[model samples]
Every structure is written in structure tokens, then in C-alpha cells.
Target: MRYLFLLFMLFTFQLNAQVVADDFEGFGTIYSWYGDDCIVDANFLNPYQQGINVSNTVLEYHDIGGQYANVQFDIDTTYDLTMNNSFSLNVYVPSSGLTGSEINQISLKLQDKNIEFPWMTQSEIVKPIVLDQWQTITFDFENDFYINLDSNSLPPIERTDFNRVVIQVNGENNDDEVLAYLDDVLYFDTVSNNPIYDNLVWFDEFDGNGPVDASKWFKQTQLIAGDSWANGELQHYTNRQDNSFLDNGSLKIVAKGETYNDQDVTKDYTSARLNSKFAFQYGRVEVRAKLPSIAGTWPAIWLLGKNINEDGGYWDAAGFGNTSWPLCGEIDIMEPNVAKNQILATWHWDNGSGYQINSNSVPSTNANTSQNWHIYTLEWSEDTMKIYMDDTLVNQMDSVNPFNQEYYILLNVAMGGSLGGDIQPGFNQDAMEIDYVRVYQETPLSVQHFEKNKVSFYPNPVQNKLHIDTHQFANTNTKVQITDLSGRIISKKQYAENGDTLIYNTSALNVGVYFMTLSFDNGINQTFKFIKQ
Candidate 1:
């Protein structure tokens, strides 16, 4: 009976897989729906509950005489207008509750939320609303007439940059009062079959003790500007092992309240900054780390464009520097402001005219960032970039021109910068501990295809040794990692100059399900699930 019920549930889910952006009755996929220059109650009781759509709760939008009043929301994923170009909503406007002589119409606008002024590059569709009646309105961007606020902007169907939705009852820039109710807001789209990024391109497990791997990282100690670093930071970065080291299978970046001198200058604090030797374009970066507990410590795991013309940088020293930043772009995956108890993810770039930035912050109290280990991730693609904390989406933005190139990773802990407020009077030292940093990119073949066509392993349910055949991957280094079902790493081994077959011992593992991932240096990976019995 249980199996039969599971099969029936799967069948029902497949039949109704259409994406519902939001519905006031509760199953809304978007959570950040809010108001701009207006007052809104997303879970208000239906005032006039007698119509074809008599839902219990609906979105109450009250434009209390504010100019440019509207209700807006941002989604973690952009609307792929190529496949789903239509949106439908049910709206009700009471003529008695309105005081404006404006036209009785509702406008649906799609915008790129990362820009300074989103409406400047927006695509909009206006529909007339009937007073004292609930009307169902549909805006079909592919078929209906749409107006692009920016004449140079592409058509809605040809763009993947619309991640924000704005609904306004009347025209903007007027002190007109309006009262409206909205329900069943949805964007229809077929089930997506997009490719998954499972191939491991690059990683640093930070194994062993002492200094970091020189081949994979460069300690950046050079002071920027004349006396201090950017953002009024008080730390003087040093190359010494005391500030940065590996211990007990983790990387520790220590920040100390001590007077240090570098480049003929002295500072009251010292820390370490490490730049990754490897650089890549679009991919997924995951870092499992714990932040510092000190009130003034600012720990960051970020990325910078490889072409940044900063002095003493790894890429700049290698003669790849040309553009100055923010022209070169910056992506801050995770930066904790200890004083404010918030974690920020920001993007900086040159928007042709000047420097532009888009940022989002999450309260650290919810995640206990300084007291617990969390996985911070940045999923980057040609269309969008999404930041995640412990697998929960925190911020997302559409990709711009500056983010289409290669970027290198950076790990540092700064003291008392612009974001990191005042330090504790008795502050001594604190450290940010990192377990691992891994980068994954998409491969030509899927996981099933790669495992079936290129590699093979025997004894799916084995008691001890398991043998893997890798004749297709010769004369290259491969990293093998084994983990339990809970994603806890069990063991890791490196095979350099390996032969056709490799043996992995599983005698120590208890009887359970485990996963083994084979990561090749040539930017490919395959995972196999097996039983240890």
C-alpha cells in the first residue's frame, strides 16, 4: 500500500509541474515579495469575498498617496521568457476606495533588479481594470504588445534578465490614492531539464599542516595604497605562518591585535590574505567555513576578475592585469560583519557610466555564523549568479558583461573595516576556520553517461576492497573522495601517475550506503553509489 501511494503521488506531481511564482493562498515560490513606496499586506483577509475567485487571503496593496507606488518582488531564478512568456493574475479595485482621477488600469513590469534604476530597462504591459469586479488578466509578452522602457533593450522574449516583477494599479509620479487586492499571481513554465553542474573542475581540501600549497595559493602581503588597505582596514597582511596556517585538517586565518610594520608602515593589527592560483569562468564554488567570533573581525570568501590591475596580485604579477576595478568586477560570496550580526553577498562592476553595486544581507543570528560551520556557495552561470548559505538561497542577480570572464578566488580576514565596526576593547585574537573549497562546472556528458561510457567499478555491495577501472584517464592526477549519505567526508586519497586500475579499502567503513567521487585534473568528475556491507 505504501509503494502504491508513492507511485500515485509521483504521477500527480508530474501532471501538475507548472511553476507557480506566487499565490496568496500560501504555496508561493517567491518569498521576497514586498512593496516599493507603498503599503502592502501579503496575507490580508479578502475584503469583498463574493466573486468567481473567493480566496480566503490575498495581497492588499494600499498606495497611500506615494509617488511611484507599486508592489514588487525578486526571484532567485530569472524568468526564461523563451519558454514561459505569460503571466496571469486576479485583481480587484474598488472605485470608492480610490481618490485619484487617473486611468483605471494595472501595469505588470518585468525588470533587471541588479541595475541602479530597474525601471530604466524594464518591459511593461498595461491592462485595464474594471471597478467593483474581480477580473482575470493575462499579460503575454510573446503575443501581446509590450513597451521597453529603454529603447535599446532587447524584447522580453529574447532576454533572460528579468528577475523582478512589479504591479502597479495606476500610473506613477502622482500623489494618487489607490486600494487594490491581488491573488493567484503566476508565471507558467514547463518543467525545466537544464544541465547540472556535477563535474569537479578545481578544489583545495587544505590537507596537511604548516604553510598552504604554493602551487594552489599565493600569500598576498603587499600593502595597498600608501599606508592602509582599502575600506579603512586596520590590518597589515603578512606572509608569516602565524597569521595563516593549516591545522587539524583545516585552514585557519588568524587576526591578531598586535602592532605590525610592513612596507615602511606600522599597524595595530595583522592578518593574512591568500589568493588562489587557479582561475575559471562560470562555475559553482562551495566553501565550508566558520567565521571569526571577534566583534571587529571581517572574514570574507570572495572572487575578483583575473584582469584586475591591482599591484602585487597573483594574476597581475603574471602580466594579465589591464583594467582597474570596479571595471574588472568583484563577486563577494560571503562576508560577515560581526558587529551587525549580518552576512553580506555583494557584486561590484562598471555599468559603462560608473561603478554600480548590488548587495543582499542575511542576519547572522539566524545562521549562527560565528558559532557554527556553514557551507557558502556561489552558483555562477552565463545568465545569473545565485548565492547560497547552507543550501538556502540568499541573493541572486542577472549576469552582466563584466562577469562573463575569468575570476580568481580570495580568502582573507580584515580588521575594523568599513563594514566591520568597532573592535572589542580587550580583543586579542580570532580565527576563521575553513574545511574545504571546491569548484564544479558542467561537463559535456551527464553523470550517468560519464560513469557508463568512461569508467567502471566492481562490487557494488562489497565488504572490503573495491576496484575501479580508469584506463580511459591515464597519466593524470585524480582525487578520490568518499563520503557518507550525510555528506560527511570519510576519506580522501590522491592518485598521481596511476595505472589502469586503483584499489580503495573500505574495511573501516560500517555497513551503509556511501558515495565515491573521482575528480580528474582535466576538469571532469564522476560519482558512484555503492553499498558497504
Candidate 2:
């Protein structure tokens, strides 16, 4: 028994030590590939311009807006991707002209040639995508790949029989004929037990005195012109610090029961509502706030689309009803009804009926643990909203619907209204204390390359021709936009590619200081100042 255990340990170590590398360094010798509506040749390019021989020839997919284009690899032997825990890929996608729908529009799949058609494991491209430059996309097989089997009399596509690998563009993006490329596909066996997001794009620490950072937040103080801000809420939101202010290192939204007037209306309650100046469509949001324990207090951390058209014109001058409530979706991350001891996570949309909402309610905390600091989180991705309290998932909503669009964050406190309940006699002022609000965007691409190759643009104070040497293949994404010092775009030009050098003519330009921004397919943009004298 002791020798058996020792042998097993040795076998496990040997398995984990194995690594795979298929860089496609050779030209169709040991391994080969093919494309369908996609042309998979690195040598043949349309219109025939000089092409660069990148250290390595990547898998080129010339997708001409067809049903789809896929790359099938010739694996010498059966491949088992599940055996390895992680893999890395080099990919590029042009950022310009891409809609929110095209963000995660890349995917991977595999098939066992021994089985019939569709006998494969294809995963949804849930991974994040950055555009216009080269970036490494890492996949943790334990989470990114799997095979779902259905009823079949024949044996399913066993993991050991997956002899063909397919790389595809998730046929959803509206790209006319994008020239996509892939390089250095490598695999490893270490399973990562960490979160996918490692980048912080925006956040509010709520630190110091005075008003909140104007660059990060904006307070909403106006009442809806003809109507109050929906719900029978009694709070007259104000822009004053008395209602919303920074106390110590936290934010305080005080709900007071007193007569106050704002925007041609009077109310018996006054509070504050703040909106983030920036809007985001997807990411992780975490807010640590202490709810008001006062019987009449209601606090909420939520979001709403920025375009909630409320200018009285049903349409734009000509009258067509552009947009309004519900069409502009609302996401209520957490609304703690102190009086009811329940937390509500509701999603509201407009299907022509003022509002249509789906909600879930859960105990804010254990009876004894009430009125304490709790971490409320909203893990929002492309099409899902997962609400959590202190790390426990309380509610989840599917269907992206309105959430697929960009929306801004809002924090507010209300008193003695619909959900706030009856106010106790002599209700003074109670506050919702917020430790911090942090927003993290999806990033952390797979194993990245640290090559120091510089993509140069020259003719600093040019009069006519400008030259650029991009060590990458020149696709439709290779272009430059020249903007004036005042930030107005002067002209945008596509480069004439010849090997690794791209030539742009700036001969017809006014003489002045200008900025030239070079954009690529893999989320890379380089800007340089130039003089057009």
C-alpha cells in the first residue's frame, strides 16, 4: 500500500510537468490548418501590398462577412485540453467601430474526428476582450472549457479523442471583413484559483472634505419637471452637504424629517442623491455601507441608464419618443428597508408600461446581526447581475436587456415614504454610512508577452510624408488620426502598408501643433505630437 501511494504521487508529478507549445513556426510541415469562409493564408493578402514576415507567421483569418470563419488545426495525435489547466493565446481585434455587442466576440472549440458532426465542446466567449493591439488571452480550462453530452446511442466525443482544434469568431459582431490574426498558442497544467478581474478602472474612496470629486461624481438635485422622481418617495433631494457629505473617511447620506423645498416643490423630508459622472456597461461593483437603523430610514445603492430623456418632448423636435424610464433600465444593487429588515434587489425595465420590475428579497442579516456594516456587491457582466451580501449571493438576474447599455451609479437615502414606513416621533437625522465604493473592470488577460518592440511614427515636424514602422501586420486597423491642439480632429488617414513600414501623407495640412494617434487591432493606441508646418 505504501509503494502504491508513492507510485501514484510520482505519476501525478510527471503529468503536471508536461507542457505543450504549437507556435505554427513551421509552414504547413508538422502541423497545418484550414479556413472555411475564412482564408487562413499568411502569404496571400487582398490588393497585394508588401507584407512583413513577423518573427512568427500567425493564423490569419480573412473573414468576409460570411456566416462564419473557423480555423481547424491538424493535431498530430488526439488532444485533451482538459488535461491542462490553463492556456495562452495572442489575439488582435480592432477597437474602432465595434459596438458593445462585439466586446467578447471570440471563442474556442474542439471536435473528435472519430465522432459525427457537432460532437464537440464549445464554450461561450465569456472572457473579456481588449481591442486594437496584441494581448495574451489566458484560459483556465477548469472554468473556460467543458463538454456537455446529450442522449446518444454512440459514444460521446471522449476528451482523449479530440484530434481537431477550432478557433472561431463568435459570429455576432458586425465586422464587414475583418482581418484577424492569432499567434503563440501555448498550454500549461496549473489550475488558477483566483478571480478573473485584476484591474481597477474607476473608484471613489470618498476621502477628505468639501464636495465629492467632480470628475468622479455628480449630485442630482432637480425634481422631475412635471412629476416627482418615481415612487411615492418623500425626500426632496438637495445638493447641500447637510444631506450628503464626507465624514472622516466615509460618505454620509443623511435622511431628515423636516419640511424642505426644491425645484418648485415642498416636501416633509430632505436627503441627497448622487450620480457617478462616469458610466460603465459591465464590471464588478463593491460598496461597503452601513444602513440606517432608524425606523423611517431607507437607503439604496443603485444605477440607471444615463439617457433617461425627460425634456417634455416625447420625441426629438419631430416627435418620435426617443427614450424614457424602463427603456432606460434600472439596477437596484441593494435597497435595505430598515423598518422591514429585508434587502431588496430589483431590476426594472420599460416594456411600454411605465415600468416592469423583477425583484428578490432576502433578510438583510441575522436578527441579531442587524444594523451593522455589510459589504454589498453587484457582480455585473455582459448579461447577468449577481447580488451579494458579505460574500453570499442573495439574488441573481439574467437577460441583459437594458443593462447591456452604459449606466451611471447612484446612492441615496429616503425617509417616511412608500417603503420607509412610519416615522418615529421627533425623527431627527439618521445617516447611511458608506466606507467606500470601488468599481473594477474586467482585465487580466492570459499569459502576456513582455517584448519591448517599439512601434515608431516619424517626421516630427513634417511638411509632407510621415512614416511609421509597426512591427505587426498591417490590417484594416492600421490607421492614424491627426487632431489639433484644441482636440478637434483635423484629418484621419489610412496607411499604405509596405512590409513593416506604413506611409501616410500629411502634405495637405495647415501649419500648427497637432497630435497623431496610431490605432491597432489588439487594443493598442499610441499618440505623438507633430508639427504640420
Candidate 3:
């Protein structure tokens, strides 16, 4: 009977995939929709959005009258929540979006269609959205499946047969003035609609190398032109084997405190900077590296516009002929401050007026960034740039400025600069070790396909439930288990040996970290760690 129920659930799930119920594309003017306390703001320009999409009319919530005042709207189409159970929408929250002393969180009221009156269940979003940016708010019904009711006369809210979506901005029973912007409401299946990026434009494992690959990478010495690398940097870059080398499938850039004179330019510290010969316009990049522990060591994995040769990565006796920096865009992927547990992503460009630097920094409150290996990622398209560390979104930005041009990769370590401050006198030598650097472009699948395409799960610090899907797991015994860090089993489930998709509920677990493992009959086991916050 358990297997039978699982089979039926999978069957029903496969039948109800995601279709665009309503995009709110032409909501007020061309199309018809009903909303209270909100109207289409046609003239207001949206500074941030997807690349292909322009600043269209967004449903704006004006001065939401008073405490508990809200702008409510409903999607009139019938949606089968059993399959397409996630409701996603984009909300623009200005710096002053949340006004007055109100406990954070907005309430989403979903109603089921009924003959007389629909059954309403309200869910509160406790996760606060970042301000002064456009954020896609996704509500997975399976995660926080709580139903807050004022009157208990109606039966429990049903999840399998829901057809309507009613949302109240700032509706967690809190009273306050709220102003917000809403757009692109969608219902989607988390697994079937999984996005993939498979094109491997460039990658360097740095394995079996004496010197860095000259065809793909070149060393940048500050003495190439003059050692005037900006930001009060204190490092003399060298292309010698003492500064950079590969061993055991890892590239190490050693930073030494005592440096000798070279080509009339001398510094107390010597390090290495390698710039890529390959330049790409738009793509996703992932770099796995363990950082240096010494104080005042600024290890960076970054990019610069190939056209801008100010730093002189590939300079000749004639020098690179380009305009200059600020005319050329710069994207800082991972720049971990010296001796700090924080990382920052910065964008520098000239906006036809003046130079601007927009940096988004995220700090680790628990541990130092130099403690272990981490995967730093940057997803860049035409107009959008998002950064992540170990799959946690550091921040996102939207702009089509000078960053629209092609940029090449750069890796280096600088000591005692603006961000890297206070070098310890006793510091001698430390190295930033890198495992691999992989660059991928938009495609139909993921780069993980290079590993035979194992099971995939997403939204890694999973909020409530973990969705797992495997394309090739055939008629074999399969069991997935969730366990704590101490190897204690929290929950386990045995699925039918044939299906490619399954789910594990983590809502009932504690608010700590846990591990999930998938066991197959072919003696293969895959385990991944996730947080249930």
C-alpha cells in the first residue's frame, strides 16, 4: 500500500506540470484583473528587471490606508496545486517599503474554489526581502504549509485542488503603512521546471602543470609597465615559479613578505597575478579555492573588461591600446578581505557621467572564510548579475552599463590596501590554493553532466522540503534518507524503484543543519548537506 500510494502520487504529480497561469503581462490596460488598494503604475520607470523585459506597468500599492491596510489580488485561473505547487512573484521594495513599527513578514491568502464561498488559508512569509532591489518571491506551498484561520468553521485547507491565489502585502496580522510594487506572478513545479546550464565555454582544472598554461593564462607583473597598481597595493607580481606553481592538481599562488628587487620596481611582498587569455561576454563562472590565513592578504578571483588594459595583463613594448578604466567595466567575483570572514562582489563602470562603484558584501558570522574550501559563483547575463558563495546568494544586481562588454578572468593576492588593512609584522608567507575554475554559458543542461548527471537538488539551504530528481535511476531499489551531522537518522523514505522524482519534507525538523543521502541498488550512494531554516 505504501508503494501504491507513492506510485499514485508520482502519477498525479507528473500529470499536473506548470503552465503560465497568468503573467500579469497586460494586467490593467490591455487585460482585465481585479485588485483592491492597488493600481497599474504605468509611468513609473523600473530601474531593475530581467534583460528581455522592459519597464512595463507594475501593480503598485499606494499608501496602503492604515494598520492592516493591504493591496489584495487574485489569479482567477484554476491551478492544480498538487503538481504546480509553488507561487512565484517579483516584488520591488524600496528603501522605505516597510514603514512604521511592524513585525516583518507578509501574508499570502490562498483560497480554494467552492460553490458558496472558498476556503481561505493564510501563510506568512517570515523571510525578509532585500530592499532597494527587485526580488523574485517564491512561495513553495509544501514548505510552510501552515494555515492561519480566524474562524474554524471551514474544513482544513486542501493542497491538491487549489485554484486561486490571494495575497495581502504586509498581512501578517500586523498594522502599518506599506508601499510596494508587484509583477510577474507565476505557479511552477520545482523539479520538472529545473533550469540547466550545460555549455562549457572554458575550464581549467590546473592539473599536471609545471607553469600555468600560456595559451589560456598569463602572469601579470606590476613591473610590466610601472608598479602603480591602484588602491595602495603593496605587492610586486612575479611570473617566476617561486610565486606560482601547480602540484597535486591544484594551483597555488604564494605570497611572500620578503621580496627582492626586480626591474627597478621593488616591494616588501611578492605575489602572482594570472589573467586569462580567453575573454567571454556573458556566462556563469565557478571557482573553488581555499584562501590564505595571514593577515593583510587580499585574495581575489575577479574579472576586467578585455578592452581595458590599464592593469596591463597582456602588455607589449607598445602597450595595450584602449580608452581606459571606468570606460571598461570591472566585475569582482570573490574578493575576501584580509583576515576577515566576509566576501564582496563589486561592479565598477562609468555611467557616461561619473565613475561609480556598487559593492554587495556578505559576512560570515559563524566562521572565517579562510577556514576551508568554498565554491564562489557568479551568474551574469545581459542585464543581470548575481553572486553566490556555496550556493547562498550574496546579492543580485541589474544593470546594462559597461558590463555589457566582454571581460577576462584575473586572480591575484594583494597585501595592505584599502580593503586589506593592517599587515602583521611577523607575517612571512602564505598561499591561496585553488582547485579548479570552470566557466559555463547558458544551455539546456548543467555542467554537472560531466559527472554522468547524478541526482540534483536545489535551493541548497532548503527552506522546507528538498526536491530530488534523477533521469537515469531505473528499476533499482532506491531509498533516500535525511540525517543530522552526528549521523542520527531524522527521517527516511523508500520510493518506487522506477520514478525519477521524489520529495523529502524537512519542515518538521529542527532549525539546524542536516544531511541527506540517496542510496541506489547499484551500490551507489550520494549524500549532500542542507540547512532547514
Candidate 4:
């Protein structure tokens, strides 16, 4: 047995040694990527300039009254890239038509094979000018995050091979007059040698036809107070395309103030809410998203109990499990209050019984939570729950109180709620975009026996109370304790002279895995695994 154990240890170490590189460095030549024209060959693009009244050059400076300009390039053919790895690109925009308040739109995109556009941060890649000369534009694909690329959404990429690249003018802003310039678009290598994460189990690239996958998600459409949400929330959610759309390899949940269905009442708000029906007990959950920045916007990524309705009550109704306001646990993995530009991770739970339970919150370490896209994640185990912002563990719960139940995922941009209060006047209507939500499960490790005694328990996976027979050690002083997998002690009791058997009332325990330990005065200990139903 010792020899076999040593062999297993050696194999585990070898597996951990195999590191996969995430960062990639691209070659420095632009000519190496172009086929014939000075134009860079890419996966997809729509430089509107070729349409009628637009410029194709990277250097142009006239906004046509009703005209526009754009440039498109495909990166798929430029490098052999994997969604599991990171890649970088270089872009040069020597000058852009920027007056005091005029924000000219220039963008970087990771397009699907169809050449549809999903613009990156600032909605317009900003280029600070030095002089009137050509400036070296450096775009690191890995450094500057774009639309999320998942296992299935990333277009086929190759070395010096690309599908498309595009640059466009904001026809709504420019009087068909502002001109933008670009040059030296290149792809390079990344720096990741070993991934901190690889245990992905499920995800939706939102690449197929339809309103997300119905089997994986459910859409809610009960307009609250003339809007689909309450708390004076701004966006009026609808199934209509104007408020929500699935195009260009993304699921766009736009919040606008347009007339659709039969409501002519205008206050400026339209959006969409998508919920996950697949409940999970304990695992890692992550979402890569670009949040909306409107003043009244209350965007959030959170979780809800799966059996919330088992008690015969609606979500917001009165006494339902712990849902009794602060008791019925709420895990807010990511929430951006807009005006603050800060991200918050919080937890709310009912302390066994109360009008309001205890709650905690922590600000994220990253700056400008709503300006750029970011990956927000939560790690939940048997005894503890942790929240991670961009690879940093910020907040954690380890009291072993009562958070060991199944929970489903929820993502939405509420206008107003108990948290955001209500939408104020003059709020912009923009979408809270989501790239994708992914789940991963870690491999369980083998157990090593510590100490043992003759004390025994029977009929595990019990439906009612449990009984422990201490007939084997009649004179030993034994203390009993029950703890969950996360190492949170749930219940503890002491026993005197061990004669026949002792009974434990477990009517209040939830259905899940648990551990029971019995310690004697002589330092002897015995542990047993059990389940409660």
C-alpha cells in the first residue's frame, strides 16, 4: 500500500508540472499579414467608407453631414489562437478628431466569421494624440479586453492570418465630418505559462440562433410599474429586438426608451433579463461582462435559492425559507452602482431567525468597474464561500452558520430595487452586456485516516433523527460534533457513561453531506460520514 501511494503522489506532481502558455508574442511585420493590398487581411470587417460617403484610409479628417467612415479587419486568419490562451494585437491611430466634448468613435473588435461588430471598451478605443504626425498604435489583444471569446465563440485564428478588422465613425455624433487615422495593426504572443483555472464544466457562447438557450436559461417578462422591473428601475424589459438582440455572436440586452408592444408611455427605458434554471450545490461561478453606466442603472450578477418556491411562496413574498429578507441568503457576486464606478461583493443572510440578518460588503481592487469588461467569480465549497475579482480573493464567509444549500444563478440590470433605491431623472438608456457565464468543479482529494474508535452510528442518509450506539467504549468520555464539508461546525454535544445508544435530533438539518466526530478522554477519535434527508 505504501508503494502504491508513493506512485500516485509522483503521478500527481507530474500532472501539475505540465503548464500551458496563455500569453503569445506576435511577429513585428505588417507586410507579413497582408496578401496584396496595403490593407490588412482579417476575419471580418465593415469599414462603411466603401459604402458611399466614407474614407478607407487610416488617415482621414472630414465628417460628412449624412456620411460616415469605417475600417474592418479579420484576426482569425492572422494567428493560430485558442480561446484558452491569450493573444495581443497592435493598432496605431496617429490622430482623431477630438474637440472639447466630442468623443469620436474608434473601436477594436473580436468578430465571428460573419463579420458582425461587438465594440470593445469606451465603446470607442481612445487614442491620445501627441502631434499631427503618424503615431505607433499598439493594441495588446490580451491586455485590452474585448468582447469575451469562449470555447465556441472565438473565430478561427492563425499566425499572420486574419479574418477581419473594422474602424467606424459614429454617424449619430459626427456631422459626417470627423476623420480618424490608423496604422500598423499587428498580433503578438502572450505571457501565461500555467493557467490558474481549467476546470470549466458549462457555458453559453450565445452563438446560435434564438433568445439564448431555453433549456439553459429562462427569460422573465412581467413589467413592473409600466416597466418589467420594480423599485423605479429604468429599463422596461421586452422580448422585442430593440430592447434585446442576439447578433454578431453576442446576446445584447439593450435598455432603451422606445415604443414597442402597445405602450406609448415614454420615460426612456427598455432592457432584458435572463435567468439560469440549472441549480448548483457547490462550485465555482464566473461571468465576463461589460456593465451599463447610465445614472439610474443597477446592474448585478447574483444567485437565488432553487427551492425558493417549495414553501409555496413567490420570491418577494413573506416567509419563504431563509428568503425572509436578509435570512434567505443573497450572494451578490458583482454589482455596480454606476455613479460610484466601483464594484461591490456582498452577502446577506438571515441569522437563524430575524427581521433582518447580518450583511457584509467590500469594494473591488480594480478601478472603474463599469468602464471596461471584467471577469467576476465566486468560489463556494462545503464550509465557506469566497468572491474573487480579477484573480484576487476580496471577500469570504467561513462562520459555518447556514449557507449549504443549492442555488441558481441570476444576471440582470435592475432600474431600482431594495439596493439601488429608485431611478433618478435624466438617466441614459444603454445595455448591460454579458459575454458569458461559466462553471467549474474542482477534483476531490482522497482522504487519510487519522484515528479510530469502536463508537458507531447507523442508517446514514437519515430522514429524521440519528442514534449513536456507544456499547464498545462504556467507560470512555466521548464528545460529539457535527461539521459540514467547509469545516463549519453545525452542532456539538457531550455524552457520559456509554451504555446502549444516544439519540440526536436532526429534523432541522438540510439534505446534504455532513461529518460526525467522536473524541474520547484518552485522545482516541473516530469519524463517520452521514447524510440528512
CA lDDT of every candidate: 0.79, 0.61, 0.64, 0.50
Find the candidate with the highest lDDT and give its number.
Answer: 1
* Regions more than 4 Å wrong, model 3: 1-196, 223-227, 315-321, 363-368, 442-533
Q: Judge candidate 2 against the unseen true structure and give its global Cα lDDT, from 0 to 1.
A: 0.61
Between prediction 1 and prediction 2, the one with superior lDDT is 1
- Which 10-residue window of candidate 4 scores lowest in summed lDDT? 1-10
Write model 4 residue lDDT over 13-125, tens digit each, in one string. Answer: 11122122111111122222222112233322213322111212232223334333444444324333433123222232224433334433344444443434333211222
lDDT of 1: 0.79
Model 1 lDDT per residue over 402-471, tens place? 9999999999999997877788897799999999999999886764553433555665556678877765
In Å, residue 21's CA in model 3 sits off its true spot by: 11
How displaced is residue 469 in candidate 2, in Å?
Answer: 31
Candidate 4: segments with Cα more than 4 A from true spot: 1-199, 208-210, 223-230, 259-268, 310-327, 355-366, 399-402, 417-428, 443-533
Q: How many residue pairs clash in each candidate?
A: 0, 11, 1, 75
Please write out the lDDT profile of model 2 over residues 1-533, one tens digit for every residue. Answer: 11100000000112233334444443122255688677777443222111111223466666776555577665567655455545555676554533335434566555566656743343322244555665555554444323244323222223465565567664533545556667656544443322344578888888886666667666677676454765667678887878888878888888888888767788888898887766777777889888787777778899877776744321222243356777988889888664566888888897564566767666755732235778888877653577877765566655457778777788988776677777778888888888888888756451132122345555554568767665653444566787653445778866545377677788887655455777776766655444454
lDDT-better candidate, 3 vs 4: 3
> How does model 1 score by TM-score?
0.56
Question: Which run of 10 residues does model 1 get worst, by summed lDDT?
Answer: 2-11
Quote the positional error of residue 496 for candidate 2 in Å: 32
